[model samples]
Target: MSLSFASSPFSVVCSEVSFAWPDGTTVLDGLDAAFGTGRTGLIGVNGSGKSTLLALIAGELSPASGTVGVAGEIGYLPQNLPLGTARTVSDLLGISATRSALHAIERGEATEENFTAVGEDWDVEERARAELDRLGLDGLGLDRTVATLSGGEAVMVGLAAQLLARPDVLLLDEPTNNLDLDARRRLYEAVSSWPGVLIVVSHDRELLDLVDEIADLREGGVRSFGGNLSAYEELLAVEREAAERAVRVAGSDMRRQKRELEEAHVKLARRVRYGDKMYEQKREPKVIMQERKRQAQVSAGKHRLMHEDRLSDARERLSEAEEAVRADAEIRVRLPATEVPAGRTVLTVNGLPAQQPASLEELIVRGPERIALTGPNGSGKTTFLRSLLGEGPEGLQVKIGVEGVRYLPQRLDVLDDRLSVVDNVRAFAPSASVNTVRAGLARFLFRGRRAEQPAGTLSGGERFRAVLAALMLAEPAPQLLMLDEPTNNLDMASARRLSEALEAYQGALIVVSHDVPFLRTIGITRWLHLDRDTGLTEIEPM
Candidate 1:
């Protein structure tokens, strides 16, 4: 049956929406949501159907048994963009056809087909160019090929296409995943100034902070919370505190009920003994004794039943209290073996040659210094990391003070997909027994059968944890860990868990990430920005 939230003043609506993957993993089940004017930030754990719901609203996917309603034209930008190299900027902007028709007419070939194509969109190119300029693609030509654009630029272009369309409703899924600081700011500006119904699905704290409201998709439904990310977090904290208090109170009640039940049993046994003694003493007449015994049995049954029912109710209450409490897991227990001495040089970088206009030079990392590498896209962040680690098949020349260096690239392709997570870690640490690997995996939230599952079958968060376990549990023990965009595809929960795991890393760290809030949480001792002219230089926190 079709459904609509009566209080919703939204342009986009989903009514009793249900969807499932080909593998039979149910995502949205009879979900109802509405997005009105202004910015709505859709936040949820990974695989909670946020993307699918957006897709359904965009008409990319059909609901199995429900209706999705959009008031006007819709625009959707998915997490993974279409990266076709053959397409030009005009084509990507979705105005290539109209622009061609207009150009043909300009050349005096005024065909009926051209006029039909142009229709009422004579100013489409101008509008597209204006949107591009607004989104920080000022000098980028319309004729430029899509293949030449960086990841950030591509995202901006995609967004510009949507703006050019001027759709009444817009959907963006993980729009800022691979974006750098500059591109993110541009996108944030666009979001802030949006005039129509816009729904953005992202885990970026900064981006979410700009939304007018937060729509949390959890456990197959939408929960609307007024205000931004910080506000939602504040409200959640208060609710959780209250829930935790309830749990404590319920536990006490449960213990009291249990004690009372035991006391009732003891009192009943004592009464029974007294009654039996009286009967054995033959103090009462035969008829009276029989009547008394019968009454005692009935009273005992009633008392036992009453106590049992009270205990059962207490247990049910305790279970409900526990369920109300959040159980977000934490990563733990990095060995002291991974620790780097304060005075000992863990890494000495003489110079890093970049393909850009500038070059990176000298640094002496002598302790557990947490350094954050930040830059705009295509500024040689990944190139510099590969140079330092001597990765790639070419094996670039590099020097290091320690042999314990480990690099976690953005793609996380370090695992053997065919092997189980346990085997992957075991491959890294040959000397460690199966039991040791299992124990380490447990710390990363991979327990029992999960550890035994093939790496390819794991979800995004699970795969991240597995890769992390292997890196930390390696043979030499990474004293100098280098991570490149570690939080790229992770949801908030996974990202939080990752931060918790990194909290225990005693080794020196040099991670490349655009997540400013996350960098702050990892206790960054240094911040370096890659510039086209200045190269890699130390900078104060943003």
Candidate 2:
């Protein structure tokens, strides 16, 4: 597959770009890639430098070597929105000055500076509002502070700001990270209808399915596939099949070459034996016999060397073919210890929040029910989980019946940063020996030395595995597992692995997330919606 799109007038190009962290960790080295005027989905495993490449293209970070050339203006929305507590929606939209100037002109204070600030954006407020509405943020007024908005609202507002800029190139990093189902749908619509160069770094499959191309970054380079993610996956499936076949063929060839080399050695030995017999029989003069023996040895050496070279070439080809097969390890662990009986009362809670439905005032969970807690940002979904775990605010009253409930918060703050992965797991599974903890962690993909790496030094995906290992491998085994937005920072493969791990968890689960697809994958048996307007209520799965 090609590593770049077809060049165009408005293409963005990186020529031999190299970037490294302050710690001298190399990300992109001598990477040459181009993105033309179309929607491109940039995907890679965690730590493959997709976000770093986006930053370089957006000019948020400078390349240590080489240059980035863009033919038009660029608007970038990073993975995290750095919204200040005091910043307002207008400030986030990047139209604070224009809105203020327009208001000043409306009040008959049309100063020259105000006119310059407004410029041709006299309808900036209307446009901003339109962009907000397009992204399902219309209800959030422009005057409201960003700190009061939910996490999804802030992300949508940031994206709205970028859209309002009307730049030629739009760059979005994990744009659907915290967005709910409706918000994601809106964002997907926007992505599908985008007219200019759109480069989005996301693990959301639905969002990636709308792209014009897939740019897979691995080993410090990008490989461009001609279609969306689904098509790209299909192509990968075919390639892997072909690669596996090639490996089998190469293995056979290698074995055949080895056998041929052995046969040639045997044949050469037989010729030597025959020559020895001839010499012993005095079939030729002594000098002529010696010369003939030397000639025979030289010919035998040439034959052996040719066979050896063939065997070596076959081995090399086999090695190369083996390299073509991908080996992305997955989390596959059994959790029979977490199982709860059908008649068991895993959890029971009393006293719902104010204005909540009276029917939900006293809730009970029996056996191994999987409940999906979903709501818009700031709808108290996380609060509800915390309150159920008896970690909420002082004024709220909550009662829990479960004793061994484990909560995996959205931030994944369960691990000590200074501790090693094995140590972190052992912290929870105290009764487990170091070797036992290491054995458990290997199931979570932190095998051997990886389990010794400090939590602070781990990458996003690695940190998640460490946290999961610590939680699931705890002593006594949790019968009720609660997770809040667990897949927010995960890549697609990691998210799938999380689902796989959760599938093996035989317990009552309460997961607070906006990821409906992921919720379905883990076999959520019940769905609950917590909303400021509707309180907490059960609903059908989407």
Candidate 3:
């Protein structure tokens, strides 16, 4: 029998499903849940089983036990994307003769003769073009390679491809991670209008607030709360309080039972001795002996029950308290810095163009300042960064003062994949020995064997830390730090920690990010918005 959720109220139903990785790490245990047609937000800390849960729901992985039933077709946007570099935005949109051929095949219109004779006809090309146009990729040529596109453009292309599949459910993981403000807004609007069930995993607060329900995954289970992000947060607070109360009650009961059990044992011992002394002194021993035997049986039964109750209560209290504590703790993060003198001029730019072939006449950045580079996606944010780093046009006037500048590129292109963590750090700081490099990496949390591990095997957050470690170890330590989309793959805790470190740093900073809360926390004193239409960069107070 075929299983589909197309006509069902619940798009996904999972009953007592359990899953574990090959390495013996249990991800989900006896999980039961159902998702209806609405926007659902999945929230969890790093390695808290959020991604694994999503994969199971999307049918990418089968449950190790129980049943997972899908009621409809699903469109999944995985965290690790394998995009074809040679495919263009238009090509990714399926605007080609091949798309038409596929459509014809689906409609049973492509006969053997037609397939052989008119395979590359304009009808197919026109249909593909129309679809691409609907997705806002109208003028882009079909042959344009995807590699030339910006991060936001790449994401949009991927989203468009998934939307074209027209599935009844959509699963997206960190869809807006690298997008700028404008692109994020566009993507959000698109997802909001989607008719089917939407399950999104993201750290973006704005995106979470748009969803109808929030699913918090922790402690090997999932809990669902209705309403938007704020409402869910309120519900979480209430649940935490309730759990705390339960824990306290259990603890008190366990302590009381333990004391009673101890007291009962002492009383029973004293009674036995008193009864023995009375039996020795009395002539009517039969009645007294029978009473003593009955009394000893009652005491033994009472002690056994008390011991069992105490163990149960203690176990319950510990479990409840642990869950409550985990939920209540705030995100953890750390950032380190080196002392440096404030320089006069950090950067200067003249006639810099936005992404749409428009130009900004002049821009200037000074030292010991924090500037928030704000712009919509495809407004030349990353392009401007490249120009500042001298990778773009030669004619464009860009200059930096004598001060050292450390740049964290948006794409993490500076990392060496083949090198170990220690070697990568040493490469950046040639004067530093292996021990010094390892020590710096350790400060960033790469300890023990992890420091010797190859950079290729590290997670996204670890790689970012490795890069930061290398930057900090530089002899003169950069006086100005430029970071582009630094929080893309970071968990909530790591993002907060990095923010704290940046806030404590003495050097000048230029940051490009779409995370408003992060920007606010990191102390952005000035803001610059790049207008795509006017091709100009304007400064505004934060």
Compare the candidates by lDDT and give the number of the best one. Answer: 2
Top candidate when judged by TM-score against the true structure: 2
Candidate 2 on 1-542: residue-level lDDT in tens?
Answer: 11233345447888899997654667789998888878999988766778888889998889999888876788999876777899999999999988888999999997999999989997888888999988877677899998788778888999899888889999998888778888889999888888899999988888899999999988778899879999999999999999999999999999999999999999999999999999999977999999999999999999999999999999999999999996655665555476788888877766565464432666688898999988887787877788877787665555445557788876567789888788888889888898888888888777766677777656555677778778878876788889888887677777887888787778889998887778889999989888887777888887
Between candidates 1 and 2, name the one with more favorable TM-score: 2
**Per-residue C-alpha lDDT of model 3 across residues 129-157, encoded as one tens digit per residue:** 56455555567565678777767667776
C-alpha-based local distance difference test score of model 1: 0.81
Candidates, ranked, lDDT: 2, 1, 3
Rank candidates by TM-score, best first: 2, 1, 3
**Which 10-residue span in candidate 3 carries the lowest summed lDDT?**
327-336
Query: In candidate 1, how many Å is residue 256 off?
Result: 2.2
TM-score of the candidate numbered 3?
A: 0.72
Clashes of each: 1, 0, 6
Q: Which lDDT value does model 1 have at 126? A: 81
lDDT of 3: 0.73
TM-score of each: 0.84, 0.87, 0.72
* Candidate no. 2 TM-score: 0.87
